[model samples]
Target: MRRFSRFVCIDWSGAVGEHPPGLALAMIGQAGAPELIAPKKRWSRQAVLEWLHGLADAREDILVGLDLSLGFPFIDRGSFFPQWDGSPDSARSLWECIDRLCADDPHLAATSFLRHPEARRHFRHAKGDTGDLFEGSIGRLREVERHQRVSKQANSWSCFNLVGAGQVGKSSLTGMRMMHRLEKRIPVWPFDPIPDSGPVIIEIYTSMAARAAGLPANTSKIRDLATLERALCVFEADTPAQLDRVDDHATDALLTVAWMRQASTVPALWTPQLLTPEIAQTEGWTFGVL
Candidate 1:
């Protein structure tokens, strides 16, 4: 299959609670205006799948980026451990085939689409008293999820609004977590802080080492952030400067960190590290490269 020449950004909502009066699909090409594809509220899942199938069939070598993770990841540790405890296939299917894959296989977990440098900058931890806000932030997200489930206006009426609610909840939770974690907090989504002038490209050069190693595309080992960092480093190093438009300072920091992450796969790479030993000793572990 041919990759898509253009980008496809999906702001998706699982519609766990509400259904909007109409479904909206916006398709933008390299040139010209965006095309809207809205189908009736009565369309069945089979019909929707058929339409999507046709859409995909029509495109040649298009890089079809989905808003949803193609699969689910099976959390082996932490709060969600003990794993799938005899859960039926329905749970997996309801979560979407890709998400289910991620849940069943550890390797297929996908990163959030908002991975640009600007986006990552905004996701910094909060400072001072709220230094450990990740937990609270998650709690807030659970609350938001609960609200969606019970809100009549949301559940009975506006289906499309489900996406809005989910986005709001996620943003709220993530932002709150950032604020709570602040010894000196940074913005989690600062588009305005960046200057609009000039072509400033933000990227994450992820390593395809796992993929290249013949690891299944949806394997259990591909979810580590460290693995992704290595990919990004390799990707950035191999690509020429013309491909990037960001300022040298910002690009350097990003690339350096990305390269440093290669240590996850090769400890010897740490011999000539860019980050200070002290900082690396503390912050390095957080990158999950190991």
Candidate 2:
């Protein structure tokens, strides 16, 4: 496996207006501690994309992990938007579909897809919004999600569920728009073959990284500096003094990148049995699930 010089984790949000506290970016370089990027200013999705593009342009061998689903559940029908004539069968094609469907959305927003006549049928945007959406199914976990659940005994939410706070559907949809734009410049893992060099992106679950760092499952957010410092200590990472606040977004980003810095060294992370051509083309697996 190729070693990365920098590890970045982004805690993304799908909010429509100004970026929420949930949208945060954190990075750890080879020589320094993990710290939030633009800690003072809220970041719009467009701004975040520009920042990421700049990193790729700088020729840095970086590994970026975004806290969002790369693709929806596709194991059952071999397609995410099954039955729809134009529905894409691959994660990369799905990204293109979403980007094309939501072309008018500013800042890479996915409201267009959510409100799309046919696309909306597959997603649940709000509470009590019912349809034939498979998101409501009890055991619709993707292969990676199932692996994470069985191997780590963690609760993994379906990417199709977008109603509650635990749901990642909205964020994943918005992330798909970003991915479509970035795919040309930066390669996304599982979707694109792993490149021998240059920057690469992957889907990440922040909770998994936190659990790997010894944080309790019940603790939703790490606000205390001491607790956060201890978690960073697990990877021998320097804890930034600025992360004293109680925002889960910032903390999640910080800890995930720290965990990723360590995870990038593990060979199994890049090569898993679940990453077969079928899975890669249909349902992209999460980077750390295996």
Please write out the lDDT profile of model 2 over residues 1-290, one tens digit for every residue: 88898889999998777575579889899855898887456788888888888988987899999999888778776767766788887888888999999998887888888787777777655667754655546426678887777876467887767777788877888998988888578888877767888899988889988888887888747877788889989988997967544588888999889999998898998888766778887788888766
Clash tally for model 2 = 0
Residues 114-226 of candidate 1: C-alpha lDDT, one tens digit per residue: 23222222222323322121223322221112333354112111111113222332222222221222211111111112222211111111122333333343441333434
Q: How many residue pairs clash in each candidate?
A: 43, 0
**Model 2: runs farther than 4 Å from truth?**
135-139, 244-246
User: What lDDT does model 1 reach?
Assistant: 0.26
Q: Of the candidates shown, which would achieve the greatest lDDT relative to the real structure?
A: 2
